[model samples]
Target: MSNRIYEAYVVHENDQGKYKGNIEKKRVDDLPKHGVLIRVFYSSLNYKDALSATGHKGITNSYPHIPGIDAAGVIEHSDDRRFKEGQNVIVTSFGLGENTPGGYGQYIRVPGDWLVPMPEGLTPFESMVIGTAGFTAALGVYKLRQNDVFPEDGPILVTGATGGVGSLAVAILGRLGYNITAATGKLQKKDYLMMLGARDVIHRDKVKGQSSKPLLQSRWAGVVDTVGGSILDTAIRQTKPNGAVTCCGNILGAELNTNIYPFILRGVSLIGLDSGRCLMPLRKRIWRLLANEWKPTMLEQIAQEVSLSELDGEIKKILRGDQAGRIVVNLNINAQS
Candidate 1:
């Protein structure tokens, strides 16, 4: 360990009620105590990171907070006997990079319970490439499987197709032999979606049908919805009988305005996905799969790696839904651990 302080992108506030995140110097000792102290090798940007950076009090209640939701690194020290120095770890979702000092910095000290030993088949950098977005994508797919959704039923619809979760869902579901229909408002990115294995890319206008009818033509067997509001309501009504739809993220809007006809008549299940506050036991299981069988063949292809200093621009990109795939951040180049 070295005594030198490291740089971190900490969110601060000016008198104008605006939040700004910039690089700040901090010492290792400044990190919260408990669990293993990790020298983060890579961290990934997500929609949540953007929310925190923009001063969304619901996601981050404090100022001068670090914003990185997913991190993969080697442990430097551990208070728990189960973890040891020099062991690699992956951490995401659990209050990390949220209320706690997250992965945007060069270091993090989190509870041992929050850490998952980096699975055997993945390198630290490779794991961050998958990161939280990929993990949520896997979890959404697992939920679909749990509901007995299969490719033969009908095409699985994925909303927010070019986003971190939507892109990974398209890749993972395609790998699992499911036919995918990606829904998005960005017509120019349709080809990009198809390359990720989407059988078709439909404009968001198509899903936002004109009539507010309780039900619509049955088009999808299952759905992985990363955008909420009318898109979610539309998907719910469009799913085939007894089909499942995993609802995650509210990039569009949070509230749902729809009738219960889909659930009552068609038996559609609108499953909620809360990647954060996810149970630890299941979180580890998902990570294991991500590192192994469920791993997308194009893991590296999806991640756009950037240095810590470049995060400021990327944060805005995610907020505007212009950035494609995961943005993994490198934080330890200036550190000696």
Candidate 2:
């Protein structure tokens, strides 16, 4: 216990193209010297983590790196005046777990600007549960609202509704009094989506079947789309006049094949969501909303907690698209805890 070395899930790729990830002992001094050192207690898994762990150079260019994009803990040391020892904070996005060692480790040293004071009313576990995914969900809604879209306008469609971002979006929108329609390719998850407060759960195939006739039925006021490609195209075409659609992920496909008819004829807006580089002012505002009014009523139900030892199996499950909701990793747990 006197040793300062900590444990972390470090990833490595061999020259032969093989990849490996395991818990390795790391010393406190080994972490990069920077603004603040956080004794990370909890972190959450995301699609980007799966990509980085499996050697997706687009998401992570370096090897032997830790892969965790979201973390919540207390400050151990800080070179900046804004943070001090023992203060709880959460860090996400900002090149974390990408080129930089991420929350997969029990400790992280990052720039002062990268840390956000943990919002009031959220425990470390709760913050991790609402990590980057929750942040992105809130961002989608925030953008729509900024464009004057409101719950009274019309029903909002949330695609990829079974994923972390999508599930939380549904819950938040439902709590905000929006009529939410959850769309998922997994028919088996109908009840799960409904429990997240979605007014209705529909199969993805149904939406895909809608006619791509420039602009079709004017059905929605706003859209929170996590599945890109044809579903996004369809959502755009189906949205009502003056509606907005936030595109956040490429889970279905990166290519967005669509036309200008939705925009030209219906005056629809296609807003791109970038949770990673959102301005600090906006990031803080979004976090405040997540901790308060925009908080998802189903946050606990939509999150699963796991330890570092069990992450390997869970990571594989996530990569295969079998995981629903958020996966929070507890890094400081003792054997029994």
- Best candidate according to TM-score: 2
Residue 184 in model 2: shift from native, Å?
0.3
lDDT tens per residue, model 1, 113-219: 88889998999888888888888889899999999998888899999888999989998998888999999888798877887888999998888754688899999
| TM-score of each candidate structure, all chains considered together | 0.96, 0.97
RMSD from true fold, candidate 2: 1.8
Give lDDT tens digits, candidate 2, residues 1-337. Answer: 2246888988899999978898888887778866798888999999899889889999999788899999899998889999999999989999999998899998889999998898897889988888999899999999999888998899999999999899889988988999999998787998888888888888988777477587778889999999898899999999999999999998788998899999988889999999999999999988988889988878788888888888888889988989999999999764321
Q: What is the C-alpha RMSD of each candidate to the true structure, in Å?
A: 1.6, 1.8
Model 2: residues with Cα > 4 Å off, grouped in runs: 1-3, 334-337
Lowest-lDDT window of 10 residues in candidate 2? 328-337
Error of 1 at 231 (Å): 1.0
